[model samples]
Target: MNNKLISIALTGLLASTSISSAFGTNISIVGRIQAEYSGINIEGFSSQTTVNDPTFFSSWGIRAFEDLGNGFRVVTMIDFGFNTNGGSIGNREVFVGISKDSLGTLKFGRTHSPFADFAGGWTIDPFVYTTLQATGSGGTMIASANGLGSGSYSAVNSVVRFTSTTFNGFSFAVLLMPGDADKLEAHLGGHLGGHGNNIGDTGGENGEWDVQFAAKYVMDFQSHKLEVFGGYSRDNVSSAQKKITAFNLKTEEVGRIGGVWSYKNFSLQGQYDFISKALGAATCSDAAALGAIGDVSTRQCNTAMNPGGDGSIWYAGGQYRLGNATLIAQGGMTDANKTDVFASRKSKSFTVGGLYHMSKRTNLFGGYQHVDVIDKNSIVDRDRNTWTVGMRHLF
Candidate 1:
């Protein structure tokens, strides 16, 4: 049944691309394909390095738009990623937007948050989501109740976003999420009210409302270019919070800041993420105040009892380009000692690589990376070494 639906969808796209020309719509096919020999090495676990998957796979998208008289137009882009080695489509998305020359562009559908965009989406790190990330894969490897290898794609669904046209190299955007499994974050505490005057008087659960804001500026220094970016966001817990009888728990707030610089053929980039601020007041602990609002007591509401602390992750990288070849290196770390009872658990990784451009649409690359992870509970450390060489082509 699923295969049938997919075929219909692809056929629909092809049909639209063919007929849209009647309305003077410009449609284009765009994407890239990268094939590589990727391998990994670990201590104790004799998992030797092997060519598993490349840094990227073959994928293409269709984007179309038609000018509507004035400086306004209607646009739509549908894109997805697939594994050529396995013959499976992994990430798929579609978005429609209305753009005007004077105002800005408003897009509605599944899309990336402003944070991911400013950071370069899947390619945010030096190794481009392949390495140098928290759990690698651009930090997609998250530990959840489902398992320890949960892969979180970067795209967010049911989102409406607006990006202002650049003005004086300054641009800003706001992303509104209707909450459909896109990194929900719930904060505890209000600014003026609370069950027990916690962290500035805001105590109980802050609404399940989520919002994110991003701003950036690019400056030209004649000899070089500098771009600075910053983002702020508030999220609701997870499905667990919604299942917490009446009141699970939510984090307070989260934010990030970073910048990048480029001079001639050399560039540098880095960013820091401020993990959730578990500032919720455990109302269930003070039953007299929370009443049966907490209905059935659960660990989700035991925010205070849990490892409540602020966590942090940071990455720094630089690359140099000479002629048609480029060199890259980066280092990153994540510490959850403050938020997890298993305090002091941390991980760090380093990566270096080189890429040679064969043409405007093709490139050859090779790289190596190493990661060290410390498990607080087992007091055991795990290490991973990775290497890859691949070819990429764009159309």
Candidate 2:
């Protein structure tokens, strides 16, 4: 049954592409393919090795644009993500946007958040969307739950986002997500699972909204370049309106700041993420979180206890270009909210890697990461070590 449905959906997507092209819309296909050999060693578990794309680094998409004249254009992007090692195709980021030369762009549907765009995204994370990335896998950036707010790789759904035109290398982006879940949906937390068609994080069906906004400025000197960015994100739900009998679900709020400085062939980047009322899946296990070196499922803050929890994550990484190879080293820690009911779910990680640029669109990368995790229970405390070698090519 599922296979049949998937086949139908894929056919429809291809049909749409053909139909749109027939209407004089300019379309282009773009994406990348990444493959890696990964090995991991955990304190208690057996060492494991795999040839896979743990980061879902392989994807394809269609980008279409129709010139509306008068400096206006309509743009559409639909991306599909799949693991080269396994897993079926799934949606990555899908959105339609309107753009004007003088104004800006307004996007609707699932899209990247302001936090991922302006504040602390690829600019700060030298290895973003890769197996060695620091967002969810490395515990450097505090990720959101169910894509309700800003996360490194998660996209906001059912949202309206705007990006202003750059002026003097300064620009801003804003995102607004409306809650359309009812009481029943709120009880389920809107979308609890990782992926699929989810309306949006629960906003208690009350008059509440989720918002994220960020601004960035880039300054280039004769021999040095610097980029500064900051942003705030919030997911509000009325306690009185959506409170569950088992536990209190407070609002999730996040503040992010980061910057990058480059001189010659050397670059330094860092980001700090602060999260309050961190939410985690009730189904998360200590072993899973402890082993989340390159897994997004366990990338949340404090899952042992939600609501009222507060914590932060900070990352600092540097890159030095030596000929065609660039060396990378990054370290950061996640401090989960500590409480009497459970031990602090804190973890610290350091990653060292290098990328060999074979060409402008192809690179070979490898990295080693060590993580020390303190679980909610002392008995489950563990350490993780990971090594990966990968190659990626863009099309």
TM-score for all models, in order of appearance = 0.73, 0.83
- Candidate topping TM-score: 2
lDDT of 1 by residue, 306-375 (tens): 2344556677777787777778777776565433333454657777887777775666777877766554
Clashes of each: 10, 0
Model 2: residue 218 alpha-carbon error in angstroms: 1.0
What's the lDDT for candidate 1? 0.50
Lowest lDDT block of 10, candidate 1: 143-152
Error of 1 at 265 (Å): 1.8
Worst 10 residues of 2 by lDDT: 1-10
State candidate 1's TM-score. 0.73
